[model samples]
Target: MFKKIAILHISLPIDQVYDYLEKRYNSTLYADASEQTKGYMPKIEIREATKNSFLSFYVKGHDPFTGLSVGSWKWSYTLTQEAGGMTKLKIAYEYGLFMSFISGGTVGHQAANEICETALALDALSNAQLAQ
Candidate 1:
């Protein structure tokens, strides 16, 4: 199992930030039937949500060669309002390998790093939107 956490502070309020994330993940703007029919449909399933405080989801993964289930990426977001009315977001990510042989042992760290990088990108995007 591999895990990583990232913290970000956004200028938006906690509730707004939480809502943005919820909608972003739940959006089906890119939905397609071909992906499902091909047997490699990547998706995020909401596991738990607590108003503006916490949100958890799972990103299903599959092996490219066999098209079999390899494992899933678990992601949790915690939001809080800071003194300056900024929203503090904490992103926790974990990847557990079901078939270790297929991906070797380096996938965990790479996945964790990607998760953190995603958090950074999200922060930048949010800030850019606020600027506009």
Candidate 2:
């Protein structure tokens, strides 16, 4: 199993960020998949939390690379309110080898880097919006 993790301090409400990701990252976004994940439909499951103020989801789908057909994938996201009106988010993903075809080295590394950039950018956008 391969994993990637990212943390960000966002200037957005924790509930708002959580709600946005719960739909965007979870299987809900695939309701209208674009060619990339067509044949393999993923299942999204959410874990409700109150004590930790955290939300987690799991998606099961076919890995396009190893031809393994499909497997279960889990994504855990932690959100905590910081002292300075910012939300701390911790995002982690565990991937199966079946989908390694997207990137094993050059492509995968670049893709993950871009994803990290997007996360930072999203936080920036939140800051900008709040400023406005």
Candidate 3:
């Protein structure tokens, strides 16, 4: 098993950040049609509270780099409210490797980078929307 985690601070409120993630994950637009056709659509769940929230999803698919159906991937997000309406977000990603030849840590790192980049893009978009 391999894991990667990232902590981010977003200018948006906690609720807004949670809502954005919930909607984004629940929407089919966020997934690939080919993956869906392969019955690999991500299954998402959300738990929310007054100041904190958790979102998680799992998807089973082939590794893009090796074209191997090694195992499933789990991604989770934890959001907490902070001072001045800011949101602190934690993104966690885990990939379970079935093949001994594959380097789990390397794959986990690459996937984590991709996940972090996506989250940062989302943050930028959210901030831009607020600025308008």
> Quick one: best lDDT, which candidate?
1
TM-score of 2: 0.63
> What value does the lDDT take at residue 41 in candidate 1?
47
lDDT for residue 128 in candidate 3, whole number 0-100? 92
Deviation of model 3 at 76, angstroms:
0.9
lDDT for each residue of candidate 3 in 47-95, tens digit (9 for 90 to 100): 3333348877766546656655556667778888899888889888877
TM-score of 1: 0.75
All candidates' lDDT scores? 0.74, 0.64, 0.69
Deviation from native of the Cα of residue 87 in model 2, angstroms: 0.6
Off by over 4 Å in 1: 28-40, 97-101
Better of 1 and 3 by lDDT: 1
Q: Estimate the overall C-alpha local distance difference test score of candidate 3.
A: 0.69
The alpha-carbon lDDT assigned to residue 27 of candidate 1 equals 46
Higher-lDDT candidate among 2 and 3? Answer: 3
lDDT (0-100) at residue 103 of candidate 2? 41
lDDT of 2 at 48: 56
Question: Residue 89 lDDT in model 3?
Answer: 90
lDDT of 2 by residue, 46-79 (tens): 8654433676666555556564535555667788
Candidate order (TM-score): 1, 3, 2
Residue 91 error for model 3, in Å?
A: 0.5
For residues 24-108, could you state the per-residue lDDT of candidate 1 as single tens digits?
7544543554365554447778899999999988876677787776677787899988987788888887876553445687666
lDDT of 2: 0.64
Provide the TM-score for each candidate, comma-separated: 0.75, 0.63, 0.69
